[model samples]
Target: MTKFPVLHEEQVREFYYNVEFVEDDSLHTWVGNKSLYLDEELLEKILELPDMHCAGVQKKIMKGEYQLLFEFVNKVLLPRTEKHIMASSTDLFVMESLCKFEPLNLLALVLEHMYKTVIEHKGKHRMG
Candidate 1:
């Protein structure tokens, strides 16, 4: 069996295409651009995850969207617990550990800020 659980190819494609890197402010934003150098066939077969940002959590922290942050934590940080355990309680606790404790410690605090921003602006149509 593969060490990492399989994720949908479409989901992985979306993640990569949606990821954006803002050049001016040094803040990498997910602009949902599909203009990358990845091969279509390869992208169709593999799942790519988001990288964490090292910048401060001011973006997520000031917005009071700790729950949203937690969700990201679950998605990015709880892979180990998710892979081995089937219990909801343990999974939930592992999810909580993103904030207080960590076993893998692979979670990136930087990209999380961008995640919070994207989620907050999800439904609105910004014309700029």
Candidate 2:
């Protein structure tokens, strides 16, 4: 399991203040005149799916070998309803995009996930 650091209040403030919306909504920071955008390192660590850079990923997807990809997206990325047994459009998109080595906007990822979660439980509200 990949561990995310617990951001303190100050850290969140620093990030909000320092962050920039660069290309395609990707988060960036300009430090010492250097523009920095985190790439696939974080996602790769999260997945730990071996042979990602190999030439066979697209082939596997094409063959409908979705078990591996589905596991990562459903279990690791979004631990929602266990009934999420098969990959949704969003899950497939992540697999396809990341497989193609496309740039990832981490901020967009978080926002999209939050939006989906809210949508999924839109009317199931319960007061404590």
Q: What is the C-alpha lDDT of each candidate?
A: 0.40, 0.52
Candidate 2: TM-score? Answer: 0.41
> What TM-score does each of the candidates earn?
0.19, 0.41
For model 2, the stretches where C-alpha displacement exceeds 4 angstroms are: 1-65, 122-128
Candidate closest to the true structure, highest lDDT: 2
In candidate 1, stretches whose alpha carbon ends up further than 4 angstroms from where it belongs are 1-64, 77-87, 102-128
Writing each residue's lDDT as its tens digit, candidate 1 over 2-118 gives 699777876554654365544332332233553443332333345343222211232233334555655564466543322321223333444445556644212333233344444
Total clashing pairs in model 1: 3
Compute the lDDT for candidate 2.
Answer: 0.52
lDDT of 2 by residue, 1-128 (tens): 99998868654434444555444534575445555564345444555533122112332344445667667767787667646554655666667766778754444456456445444453442200
Considering summed lDDT, which 10 consecutive residues are worst modelled in model 1? 50-59
